[model samples]
Target: MNPNDRSIVALVMTGHGLVHTYELSIPIFMTAWLGELGVSEAALGAVVGAGYFLFGAGALPGGVLVDRFGSRRLIAGCFVGMGGAFVLLGLLPGLWGLGAALLAWGAAASVYHPAGLALISTGVQQRGRALAYHGIAGNVGIAGGPLATALLLLAFDWPTVAVLLGLPALLAAVGAWRTSFDERAAVGVHDAPDAGHGEPSPRPDDRAALWTRSKALFASGFAGVFVLVALSGLYYRGMLTFLPDLLTPLVTVDLPIDVAAGRYVYAGLLAVGIAGQYVGGRLSDHARTEWALAGALAVLAAVAVVFLPVAGVGTAALLAVSAVLGFFLFLVQPLYQATVAEYTPPEARGLSYGYTYLAIFGVGAAGAAGAGGLLQIAGPPLLFGALAGLALLGASLSGGLAVRRARVGTHP
Candidate 1:
């Protein structure tokens, strides 16, 4: 990336990583919540699901804010909000506390995707490479969060660790406010804010205009992508919500120093996902995004279908399956992100991403509660089966999207 694009990616990278750091940390904390608070997995999952739902649901308005204001302000606000939410977690330390903290974090975090993706898509010249880097940073946080939380728990208590986790974002808030970059560097002259003579950017503040903008957005074949995103989100949420706890039993074996076996494995799985994200992002720039994403989802479905059988095998086989699952789980993200860019115009990128994440984390967050209930009633086998079904549906939608675009000669 050139200097300007580097700056934009850096800002989004930092903010994105921190967001997932707090996000994935919740499950690690869930282990402690289960031990200390005496809450059932089903109840815990539901509460956590509520927060994640808001995280996605808030993206719609956040997209509007991104278009109206710009990414920088919203991101700085996100940093402050997430930091404050974690601080609340430290202070409260109860079931109700978890719910409240998560909701706060969700609201604060809701703007990030719209803000970050809009910034990158519009501001950065090299959108694909920038997204790859962004996805890698997120995987870092996704892996790092659980690993850090697990390690910290070995020394300090959960509350102290929570506060410590909160501090970094507080510091980042200052960095965000101080950082400098352009919001429309890559935009055409017509889309540039300072353009003297061109089509003015849409201000969808009025109800009729807002409705028109939204209607045109989904009608642009983004609706197919939305279905895929919702399925992907559902599978992601359901699979990860109780995965560490679920894997804890299967992965139990001798280790030098004591550790949460499942947490470390989960972290390792996500660490492996870093490569997946990279591959997906690079492929998005070259391959057909819909087709590539469909292949990834198919592989993901196979992994989910065989996950339980793999778990029954030796530890090595279980770990191998986990590594593959994690890889494909995240691999589709950048592809879908790129797909969104293909379907939407630059002027509407914010709203497009808003709806995108809303599908992924908001509506899809039901997977958490659904997984918990399934785990309680049937077990891992049935839960994995349902997850496989979600992946299959996503794969079909993505393939259908590819076929439709090809037939219409819009496969760019």
Candidate 2:
């Protein structure tokens, strides 16, 4: 790819990083936020759920807009909108205010996937690597969100933390507006114009469009892949959402170890996710995506096993297991995302990406809520066990895709 292409990907990916860093703070600092608002766990889940619902709802429309115009404009708009939402979130007074701000942020966040993925498909020769970079950048942003909030909460309040987080999004938004992506190269190679609206109206075959997508998905082994991706999203988000609570027990150990030790220990586990992101990216290039996903899930399985069996394990073992789980858990994200790209048609790639995110965040948000309920009912063993079972299901789903691909004699 040309320098311009690299520049575009870097900018878009960085914008995504900023958005996640700012917008995802609530979940990262949920304990503090809930304390400040005096809300129940279930209520917190509902608020977060509303954010995710809007996030998914906006995607399909975002896809249509990206396809109609181009990824560049949509990305620029998304960044600015997200930045505004963060600022609003910071300024919000209570639960109602927070919910409104998150809804706005989620709507803005929706634009990124379709626009960014469309840009990747348009600009890069090695689409998988490009997506991996983007995914890793977002992971870095995710890790940063919590770390930043944790540090800020030590000195300032959640409101102050929210305001500070908005700064990155504001700056990134400005940078996005100034940058120009290679639109011609970025998309339009294979994307079909919407016959419903675009000029020189083509044959309107909504039924054919549906069938075409279905056939492509089946031919590409995406039907089974979707189950794995969906299950992976469920387990991944569920684990991450409650990670702090899970670490609470570990941190509260009555040992005379340092007070700061627990905080650092927990942060260290999350920081290790960076390695997982890199490993997953590289592994996807060499191994078939299914195998790569399976490998990651296998690691998650082992982590769950070690974590569940070892009672009162020391900080070292906790850190080790947490890091290992973080590694494998996050590693699967990019690979699964790349599979979505590989499976989609060029014309509807934006829509395909939108649908993928819809499935991920939409379904995953529900999973997060369900996880809290599961924890309430059965406790951590059942919670982690259920997570493990989901990962295993994802592995089996991927295996089915492999079998289907063998029968079809090729992978799309």
State TM-scores per candidate. 0.88, 0.81
All candidates' lDDT scores?
Answer: 0.84, 0.67
Model 1, 91: alpha-carbon shift in Å? Answer: 1.6
- State the lDDT of candidate 1 residue by residue for 240-359, as single tens digits: 888888787787468887656888888888888888877887898799998999999999999999998888786798899999998898888888888887887767765666677789
Clashing pairs in 1: none
Give the number of colliding residue pairs in candidate 1.
Answer: 0
Off by over 4 Å in 2: 1-10, 120-136, 178-182, 185-220, 252-266, 308-311, 338-351
Score candidate 1 by TM-score against the native. 0.88
